[model samples]
Target: MTLTERLNQDMKTAMKEKDKLTLSVLRMVRSALKNKEIELKRPLDEEEALGVVSKELKQRKDSLHEFEQAGREDLAQKTRDEIAVLKQYLPEQLTEEELRQIVRETVAETGASSKADMGKVMKAIMPKVKGRADGKRVNRMVQEELQ
Candidate 1:
């Protein structure tokens, strides 16, 4: 099933199962998806839906960090729960080793021998990894490989 269909089904299930946390997270995601559709004046394709999910995940992660820094465990935990829910919609994440391998290959493919070539390497690699790897993690790995 498409991501949108799966999310709608899961939202209904969450409602029936009385899963408050899941229900709330799913509702937020649905709202984001709806907003994105309206913004584009069309329904999202799978990649666009994944982009929305990733954006939501990134926001939650940033909030989680801030909440933890502010010593608010309750808010941090809620953000973590939201992140877990959002993760269900992402492509399976690449392991560090796999990400490193891809970075190495990308470096070679782009002849990226130093930090100056970072942008070129990243531009070439992002499409391959897309939703599968965290951009920051990929960037770190690329820097390490280059050095």
Candidate 2:
């Protein structure tokens, strides 16, 4: 099934099971998906849905950090729960070694010789690693390789 269909089914199950945390997180995801569809005037494909999920997860992580900084453990915990639920939709993440290999390949493919070519390398690599690796981690790897 498509990601949207699967999410809808899970929403129903969550509602039936009275899983408030899961249901709330799922609803937020649904809203984000719906908003994107409305904005783009089309249904999202799996890749697009994955992108949305990644964006939401990043937002949750940032919010969790802010909450913690503000000494709001309860809110941070809620964001953590949401992040856990959202992560279920993402593909398996890349390992550090695998990420380094891909980064090396991308640098070679793009002929990126120095830190000055970081953008070129990143542009060539991000799409290949999308949803599979974190951007900051990839950036660090690229920098380390170039330097």
Candidate 3:
């Protein structure tokens, strides 16, 4: 099934199982998807849906970190639960070695000899690594490789 369909199915399952956390997360996903559709004036393909999921997951992670640092463990835990539910829709993440390999290839392809060419390398690599690797981790790897 497509990611959207799968999400809808899981939403129903969550409702049936009385999984409030999962249900809330799924509702958030549905709202994001619907909002995107309304904004773009079209439906999303699987990749587009996955992109939405990735964006939501990233937001949750950032919020979770802030909440933890602010000593709001309860809110942080809720964000963690949301992240767990959202992650089910993403493909398996790239390993560090795999991401490093892609970064090396992208650097070479873009002729990125120095830090100044970071943007070129990143533009080339983002499409290949989208939804698979974390941007911060990829940026650090590229910096380490270039320097």
Per-model TM-score, in order, reads 0.95, 0.97, 0.98
Against the correct fold, how does model 3 do in TM-score? 0.98
**TM-score of model number 2:** 0.97
Error of 2 at 92 (Å): 0.4
lDDT of 3 by residue, 34-146 (tens): 99999999999888888999999999999999999999999998898899988889999999989999999889888899999988888889889889888898989999989
Q: What's the residue-level lDDT of 20 in candidate 3?
A: 94
Candidate 1: residue 35 lDDT (0-100)? 100
Per-candidate total of colliding backbone pairs: 0, 0, 0
Stretches of candidate 2 above 4 Å error?
A: none
Location of the lowest summed lDDT over 10 successive residues in candidate 1: 133-142
Structure candidate 3, residue pairs in collision: none
Error of 2 at 9 (Å): 0.9
Estimate candidate 2's alpha-carbon lDDT, on a 0 to 1 scale.
0.94
For residues 1-147, what per-residue lDDT tens digits would candidate 2 score against the true structure? 989998999999999999999999899999999999999999888999999999999899889989999999999988888989999999999999999999999999999999999999999999998999989999999999999
List pairs with backbone clashes in candidate 2: none
Q: List candidate 3 segments past 4 Å from native.
A: none
In terms of lDDT, which candidate is strongest?
2
